[model samples]
Target: MAIDERSVHGGAALVLRLLVCVVAARAVSAVADGPLLNGNFEDPPNQSQMSGSVVTGEHAVSYWKTSGHIEFICSGQKQGDMVLTVPDGSHALRLGSGASIQQQISLTKGLYYSLTFSASRTCSQNEMLNVTAAPVSGSPAQTGELPTQTVYTSSGWDSYSWAFRAEAGLMSITVTHNCGEEEDPACGPIVDAFAIKTLSQPEASQNNMLRNGDFEEGPYIPPDSQWGVLVPPVDEDDVSPLPGWNIMAYKKSVKYIDSAHFAVPRGARAVELVSGVETALLQEVYTTVEGSWYRLEFSAGDADGCASSYDDGSSSGMKVKAYAGTAETTVDVDFRDAGGSKRGKIEFRATASPTRVVFVSLGYHTKSDNSGTLCGPVVDDVSLVPIPQPYARRLLL
Candidate 1:
């Protein structure tokens, strides 16, 4: 029984090679957790890579690729008489007319991801940013044009969220300034605090027939931001920034607020209908039995201290109208109420298979402080449950 040394050596080498292959494969498939790299734009570019504030090279900004007229802006940097405002950090990137910046990210295919970023208009009133996520396979990209004309915060900076389903394992997220040539090449939007969050698919449970009823699962909000994230209007529910809900109205957006910034009714997050009737938050709950009676419960209130005055010296108060299929009800919460929020309910018979539930603000409101900031009723803790046939019949009788 002679043991061949060559055979033993060959086997040992094969095992070592297999181990190395496994380790390399794991490294290639591993995706980074948390936000994207250098998301805040705090990492400065080299002096050689920058001509004053304008980035000259393609990869001038750390962890990002730049093209055309891109500028690295600093907090308090003055452009003429106006000083720049950096919401997330001391530094941000500005995409001039036709300029763009992008970064390649590793993502899990088939998973839905929400990209949250802060942007502010620098010059033109109708400035727009084109955000896109392109896969490496050359498939159709997911793109959205977000308008910066409507500023939500007094700081002139508003955090926005957009969601898309990943088509491949590797994709590039790009933000491009859509404006044409202007008198000032530097006139554009300042973008900062880019973050990404993988959203969990919401489902109906026994406790709550609606998905994400508490509004706890949604886009990523910067911890230091005083203003909540704005969930931009989207026609489809699958691509909505807010999971399980869609912004059904055009030229309208709903504020996805956090308890840290505003008082939430029941959970850490809630939806504020800031644009009155223009803003509509809708969700289609499935598994609803037709002709079955269901009770919809929710909390409506004023985001305390959000606006200087809730009343405009008129009888029109802050109110929210909830619509369940064909039935609807309005809930009014006084601005002077001690409690920040009040619970409201609406009972209706399901008219469709997947009944549509919508919440809309009743009247247009602006802050009494003369800031002209939009304000409306805050909605939270939404729940829908089917009532027993006997109980429903008794109530009807």
Candidate 2:
């Protein structure tokens, strides 16, 4: 049978489409890498008939090695003289005095990664484990302490995680039981569910130097509701009552605004710095680079109830400010629109390791009769991003 020229071309096109689809599927699969080999300590068949015992030097668990007196647990194995349960699967690694299980993995330098693991107390008094990571070739090491807990869950374990920046092409991570010499050196801590994931780079617009900038974290207040009253000097020092923000009231506690009662420009919540007097909210930008220029963006407005009731001569506004050492910049926002219709921005070069960003309310009480109570300006959806040198110069000019 003679084939038409058009039919021949159609068959060729169909084959090409199928080939492209197969290639795209493989590419998508490569985006997510698997966990570390034997990360759960349950891999490799128990065909060797090796019972639960102390591990030292090289072993069958992929990408892992042992040091000191480490106990390799198997399915249904119980700790010595105690009824400590395994935290995961059928296997867990228990560390005795000075024992450690370590794994070294290759990673990209200057990239961010998150390491997470499950830990629980074991047969000893001081159930302490130190999980640490450092560059194999250069840079400093960081240690996270899961310290001194004598409590153990019957079935589950507490998971701990931390984020770090890679300083070199390879990083070494170790889980060490550091309870020191106790009555029984064999009784130490337990570890399981080890994992490491590379974090994606932050988008230029979403690169916020402050944590919980939108006031979404910390205490949960329903949207459009109030977080009650937060008194002044609340959670002083470096600690923050609102997660990343340290709130200070010049006269009284400020109100935490949620979208439940008002309009939220960014996230679920914002802050009302002044209900009756001036209030300040500050966050230290620890990720800022010295001498680098950064742009600050935020939304400012007033409570919906007071937005249309300025006829009594009561006025409300906000001041958004940033400071790095002695250098600082401030932007004044008028709450005339109410309910977060205005966006404010400012740019400054960082002079310190961590710059301080502050939001102050300039709300005033009414001279005449307007309503029962009045509130200050609202601040929400704050973000900071690094400005390139050329862009920074243009902005300054």
By TM-score, the best candidate is 1
Candidate 1 off by > 4 Å: 1-33, 306-316, 337-339, 368-372
**Model 1 lDDT vs. the true structure?**
0.83
Model 2: lowest-lDDT 10 consecutive positions: 222-231
Weakest 10 consecutive residues of candidate 1 by summed lDDT: 24-33
Those runs of model 2 whose alpha carbons end farther than 4 Å from true positions after fitting are: 1-34, 44-52, 80-82, 137-139, 148-156, 200-397
lDDT of 2 at 22: 74
lDDT of 2 by residue, 124-210 (tens): 655667667787666688665554342212233544444556777677787888865567877777777666666543332356766
Give the Å shift of residue 9 in candidate 2.
55
Give the Cα-based TM-score of candidate 2 against the true structure.
0.46
Backbone clashes in model 2, listed as residue pairs: 223-259, 223-260, 224-258, 224-259, 224-260, 224-261, 230-253
What is the clash count for each candidate, in the order shown? 0, 7
Top candidate, metric lDDT? 1
Model 1 Cα lDDT, one tens digit per residue, 311-351? 45443467889999998998987765233988888898887
TM-scores for all predictions: 0.88, 0.46
